[model samples]
Target: MPILPPQQRTDPHPDRTGVRQAEAALVEHYPRLVRLAYVVLPPSLGRHRRVLAAHAVVQRALPAAGSRVRVPRVPAQSRRSGAPQGAEPAPEGAGAEQGPSGAAYGWMRLRVLRAALAHERRPRWWPGRLPAPAALRPAVPVVWGLRLFPRAGGVDELALDRALSTVDGAVRAAFALQLLEGLDASGARELLAGAAVADPGDAVRRAARLGRPDRAGARAMLWSGEFDPCTVQTRPSDLLRRRHRVRAVAAAAALCVVAGGLAFAVDAGTRPADDGRGPAGVAAPALDPARLLRTSPDRWADTSRVDFTAWPARGGRTDDNALLGRALRAWAEPPESVRVSTTPGTAAVPPAEPPQLLFADEVDGAAVVLFHDHADRVVRYAEPLSGSGGAALDFARTDDADVTTGAAVVVSRTADAARFLLAPWIAESTTRDLLAPDTPGRPLEVDPDGVTAAVPRPGAGGACDAWPVIQLRSSERIVEKHAFLLTDLGEPAPTHLTYMPKPGRGTPARQPREATGPDALLAWARTACSLRALAGSGVRSVNNWAFAEQKLPEGGASADWVCTRADTWRGPGRVLVQFLAPAASPAAPAAVVADREDTALCSKFGQHVLAATHWRAGSGRWYVLGAGSRAVTGIRATGAVRGAAGGPTLAVRAPRDADVELTGSLSEGGTLTAVH
Candidate 1:
C-alpha cells in the first residue's frame, strides 16, 4: 500500500468575512428584534428574564450574514397608522429566495415573538404579573423613553398597563402579534397553534377589550412605562406549583377518607353465606314498591286524559312463574277505598276506548303492565316468569304532564321496566318519526283524541327487530312525532326504548340523529367526512392519517361500515368498516383499498352507497379500516363495484378505464349479477 503524503486538512472555522457579515447583520436587526420580544414577553416574565429571553431569541433568529440582509420595506400607510397596512409580505420561497441572509424583517420579527412566547409554558391558571417600569428601563429603553400619553384627555398609562397584565398570557401574545407586529388573523392563528390557542381571533378580541377604541394608542401607553410594576415577590411558576401540590394533597386525603369509610361499610354489610335452603327461612323485609319505581320526578297531577295499548307475548303465553305474578298478587286487590275493575274477559278493549290500564307479555318470560290516570300519575308493573308470582313495581306522578289541557303524556322506559312519566302540559313537544315497525306479536299503538291505530310488525326470529312510529297530537296539531325501538323485547320488554326523531321533520336542526342502520349511519358519516375535509383544508389542518389507518381491519371483507364525525378536533374522525374474507382466499389489495375509500367518502360526504350497494360475508378474515382525513377530497375511490368468487372488488374507476364491469351480490341468494 503506497501511503500518499498527508493532505493538509482545511480549517473548519468560518471565514473572517462571514464572521464580520454576521456581526454587522446582528447589529442592524438586534434593536428591532429586541423591541418585538420585549413587548410580548414582559407581560408574562420578569424584566431581566424577558430581556435575556429576547436576546436569545433574536440571536437564534439572526441570519449568519446579518449585515448584508435587506430589511423588508413596510408600506408607509401601515407604519404611520394602525389600520392593518404596514407589515411586509413574506417573500416567496423565503429560505431559498432570501439565502442564508435573505430572511425578511417581518419574518425575523415574527420568529422572535414566537420564540419569546414559547420561552415560558405558562399554566392555564397562572395569574400573570408584569415587571416594574424601572426594571424594564434598562432593556426596553426605546419604549421607556417614548411619551405614551398626552397630559390632556389621554388614556391613563398606568391603568392600561394594569389591564394588559390582567389579560391572559396567550391573549396578550395574540394582541402583540396583531397590534405591534401588524400580522393578520390567519398569520396570528398559524403562529398561535403551537401555543395551544383554539381561536386567535377570540384571543385578539379579549386583548382588544383592554385597549378599547384606540387599541394602538392604549398599547403605546402601556409600553411607555406608565404603570407601576406589581409589588408581589412571588414567581408565577413557583406559586402555581405550590397551589397545584396543595390541591393534589387535599384531594388525595379526602379520597382516602372516603375509600376507608366505604370499605368499612362494605365489610360490615357483607351478607352471610347463602345455603341451599333459601335465606335461613327468614321472612323477607317488606319494601314499598312505589318507592322502588320512583326513579324520577312526578308531574301526573296535570294530566287530563290517558290512553292504553296491549299486545300478546311473542312466544304465545305469559310466564306463569314470573316475579311479576307475585307483585300482581300482592296488589291485585286494592284498598277498599280505591276503585278496581275485576272484569276477566275485558282485558281486550276497542282501539277507541280510553282504558286506564295496558297489559303485555315480554319475550323475556315476564308480564308488564302500565296504568295512567287523569291526574297524570302512572304505575309500571313487571314480573319475571321463572319465580312463582312476585313482581317488581314502580309508580309515580307524572312530573312533566300538561298542566293546562292535561292531554299530553310522556313515558320514558328502560330495559328493566323503570318508567319516567311526563305530562304534555309541562313537557316540551318535539316531533320525531319512527324508522321501522314493531316486532311480530308485539303490537304498538298510538292514540290522539281517544282514536288509536294498531302498529303492524314483522314476525319473530327475523334478522332485525321492529320499531314503532308514534305521533303525539294535541288540540293544536301533532306536537311530536317519534319512532321508538326496543332492544330487548323479552320479558318485562326492555323498559328502555330508544326514541329516534326524524331529521328536518318538525325538530330542532341542531339535534343529532340516532346512529342506526346503514342509511342513518351513512348520513352521519357524510357530515363527519365533510368536517374532516374542512379542517384538513384549513390553515391548521392536522394529519391524523396514521390514527385512522390503525382502526382499519387487517384482513377481511366487511359486513357493515361506520363513518363517525366529531365536531371538535379532540374527538375522533374516521371511517370504520369490517369485512370478512374467506380463510381460503385473502382479500386483494384493491379490495381493501376500495372498502377504505368507500368509508372515507362516506365520512366526507355522508354518502355510503357506491356502485356496490350491498355486501355479504363468508368464512374468511375480517378487517377494519380506519381512514382519517381533514380534507373532504382526501381519499377518492374510483372503480366499478364487481363481485368475484372470493369477495367483492371495488375498483377505482379513473379516466383511463372507461368501460368496467360492475357486479353485485343479491342479498337473498348470494347470486352474483352484473350491475353495470
Candidate 2:
C-alpha cells in the first residue's frame, strides 16, 4: 500500500488505497488496542486482572470497530500523533486520516489510554473524546513488563477458560474469540455460524434452526444451564434439564452459529424472518432457577430450587426441595403455564394451569399453589412426581395421630350421585412379618418429629455393623436410626451424624428448640422409631419414612414415629427393624434391631413406612397411621397446610430418620453373630 502525505490525501477514511482509512486504522492499532486493554485494568489485580479487563474492553469495542467518522488532517511531516491541524494549515486543507473505532487519541492516545487504565475501577469517556496521551506515557514501564517479559498481563488461556465457565455464552464467546482465537467480531461470527445466541448473525435461518429435530448440537446449545457468573464454567445440562419448551429453527441458522464462534450469537435473535411476518426464530430463553427465586417479590417466596428428583424418598427429608415451588408461588409464577388439558367443559386459562390437584393458598387474592409430596417411607424411585407424569392426590383433613391409622393420599372422584375414596390399603390386620440379618447401628427409632438421630458410634458404641462406619460430629448425647442412611455411591461407609439438643433444658423453656444441626435433626427423627439389635449380616436395598406431630399429654407433649422399610429387589429378601424407647422421656435416644424372614410378601424385599397426624382438638384424629411393604406400621404427623372448603389440610408427611441394612444368611435362625 502506498503512503499518502497529509495534504495529498483526498479522503482521510481510507487505507493506503484511499478506499476508506477506517479499516486500516483498526489493523494499525490492533496490537496497541490489546495492550491498551491491559493498561486499563486495576494494578492491584496485577496480571490476571489485566487479562479479564482486556477481555471486556475488546468485546465492548467489537460492535463499534466498523464505524467511520470525519477526522482532522495532521501534517505528514509531524510524528504519529501528527501536528495539530489547527496550528498548521492543510496544504489542500483536506481532513486528517480517520480509523475504525477512532477516538480522539493520536499521540495523546497514549496519555488517554494510561489515564483510562489508572481509572479502570471507573472508566467512562465522553462521546468522541479519548484519554490523554501523557497518562499512558507513565504506564510505559508496566507496558514493558507486560510485553518484554509478559509477566502474566496478557490473556492466560487456562485462566480465560476457567473464567468463561461462569459467564454467559455470548460473553464467553466474545472472550474466547478475542482472547483465544485472536479474531475480531466480524471474524469470530464468521467462525460461529450464528450460535443460539442473542446477537446471532443472519437471523431468520438461525432462529428456525434452534428447534429443528435433527440438530442435536443446536438443541444442546439452546438449553444452556444457569452457571454462577463468577465461576465462568459452561453447563451443558442447563438446556435439556430445564422444563423444555418446544420451538424450531433452520439448519442454515444453526450453521451460522457454529461458524461465528463468538459474538455473532449476540446478534442472533435480531434477524429478518422468511415470511417477513414474525420475528426471526423465537429464542427459547432459559430461566435461572436460582436468581429468579432470589428476585421473587413476595417476602415469603420460596428460597431454593430443589431437584427433588434426586432423593425421591428419605435419602429424602434432610432438605426442603420445595423452595423453587415456593419461589414460583412468591412471584405468583406457575410451575407449568398450564397443568390441565382442556376438556369439553373447562375454561382455558392460557399460560397458567393449576395442577388439577395442587395446594394453592391465595395471596392477596392471587393463587399461590405449590405442591410437595411426603412419602411414608423411602423406596426405589421408579417414577417422577408433581408434574405431567405425576398424579395429584388431594387429602381432606382428619384429626389422626397414627399415620398408618388414617387415610393416605385418597383421591375421590365424584359420579352422578356418589363419591368414592380410593386407597392402596386392604383391611387392617396384624400378621407375622420378616426381616434380614442384622448389621450395626441399631435400626433407627423414629425421632420425636418421627425421625431418629444416629449420634457417634461413640468409638464408644463400637464399630458400626462392619459395612464401614462413616463418622460425623454432633452436640448431643443420644443416637437415632433415621439420622443416617446407606447408599451405594462412593465408599460405602457409615457416615456419622450431628445433632443439637432440644431447647428448654435449663430454664422453664418454651417450645422444643428446633432439631437443626444435622445430627440433632436426625436424632429427633430417630426418637420415633424403635431399633432392635441386628446380628452379623449386610442387608440389601431398603428404605424408611416417618411423620411426627405433638400429642397433648401431661405437662407438655409426646412424640411418636412410624417407619416404612423395604428392599428394592424381587427375589428372596431380608428384613431390618428398629424403634425408639417407648419408656424414654421426650428426650432420649431410641433403639434398633434387624431380623431375617421367610416367604416374601410382595416380592422378597424389605421396606418401611412411617406417618402421623396431629389429633384434631375436636375431630379427635389420633394414632400415628403408617404401613410398610404391604404391612401397616404405626405413625405420626409431619406438617400441615390450610385445606379447601372443608378444614385444615393436614400433611401426614412421613419419616425424617435414617436407614439400616442387615448382612447374614437366610438359613440361619437370625443368630446375633457378632461381626467382630
Each model's TM-score? 0.23, 0.21
Instruction: Please estimate how well model 2 matches the true structure, expressed as its whole-model Cα lDDT.
Output: 0.26
Tens-digit per-residue lDDT, 278-359, candidate 2? 1122121211222111111221122112112111111122133353334333222224432322111112211121111122
- What TM-score would you give candidate 1 relative to the actual structure? 0.23
Model number with the top TM-score: 1
Candidate 1 off by > 4 Å: 1-186, 189-414, 421-464, 467-676
In model 2, the Cα lDDT at residue 418 comes to: 12
What is model 1's C-alpha RMSD?
A: 24.6
- lDDT per residue for candidate 1 within 142-215, as digits (tens), equals 33211122121222553343345445556767766666555565655655663446676687666654465455
